[model samples]
Target: MTSFITPCDSLADVRSAIDQIDAMLVDLLAERGRYVREAARFKRNQAEVAAPDRVKQVIDKALAHALESGAEPEVVEAVYRSMVAAFIQIESRQHQALQARQAPDAGTMSGCICA
Candidate 1:
């Protein structure tokens, strides 16, 4: 549950509200990053990290969500594109690390490479 400010007038009050919203966005992004890491575990190779079809689907969904929420679709699409690209890179690194850990010589290393 979240509490939203109504009719903010002062600069300080507006900044406070923005700060709260930014905190929530950070929490959401962290949750999304966790899911991205989990997704990396399921992927067989790095190619699956930059999945074009899923990217298109996500962008389309973001556009629809922005339109439905009275936000600018273009802005939402741009944000999603940038966010997805970053996540793809993270996933790619995670995939490579997992692959390396799975290699035969990985037995010499410690516990949980994904950690």
Candidate 2:
């Protein structure tokens, strides 16, 4: 279960709470990465993978969410920026590999008779 701002009695309690949140974060990030990789399949090239405008939109949305959730905008922006950058790189590489893998197959059926 997700926890909110709960008062801790000692450092151990605080550490435990943070550990739980970290675990949740790791799971969520992995799920997000899966979607990011899937997104590579839809992209045609590295430029589409990067999509700077989409990056700005995502960060803007994150900032808005931070403000609504009472989180520090700067901190949220910083984390999101780093996360988005890393995802972009991942997507770019995935896109290149996808293109390379498809390139060889795209011409393989050229000599086949189409009934």
Candidate 3:
């Protein structure tokens, strides 16, 4: 990762930093995706994947952290909302797949057996 304090005089330098930061963000998102998949194993149903209370809690935390980090709360909220939405979709798919594997002939189960 590039140092945040590194000075940039030219457009290319700024672009380089942005590219590096974007790469890091991709890596972090991938890691987060893995955790979301793991969490799917613990989720009981589709409602759990779209847990509203948990979403609010996460957004609130992200807002506070954004303020502390000198970033716009609105921007942080938007980004988190998008990320959470995507993760919820992923989790839902993973949950369905796991459920299908657990009960192939039983249609669908209501709750997670692993829970």
Please state every model's RMSD to the true fold in angstroms.
6.9, 3.9, 6.9
Model 2 TM-score (2 dp): 0.86
* Model 1: lDDT to the true structure: 0.89
Tens digit of per-residue lDDT, candidate 1, span 22-86: 99999999999999998999999877888999999999998988887777898998899999999
Better of 1 and 3 by TM-score: 3
Q: What is the TM-score of each predicted model, taking all chains together? A: 0.85, 0.86, 0.86
- Regions more than 4 Å wrong, model 2: 1-3, 105-115
Total residue pair clashes for candidate 2: 0
**Stretches of model 3 off by over 4 angstroms after superposition:** 1-4, 106-115
| Per-model CA lDDT versus the true structure | 0.89, 0.90, 0.90
Q: Write the per-residue lDDT of candidate 3 for residues 7-114, one digit (tens) a residue.
A: 899999999999989999999999999999999999888998889999999999999888788788888999999999999999999999999888756655746586
How far does residue 72 in candidate 2 sit from its true spot (Å)?
0.9
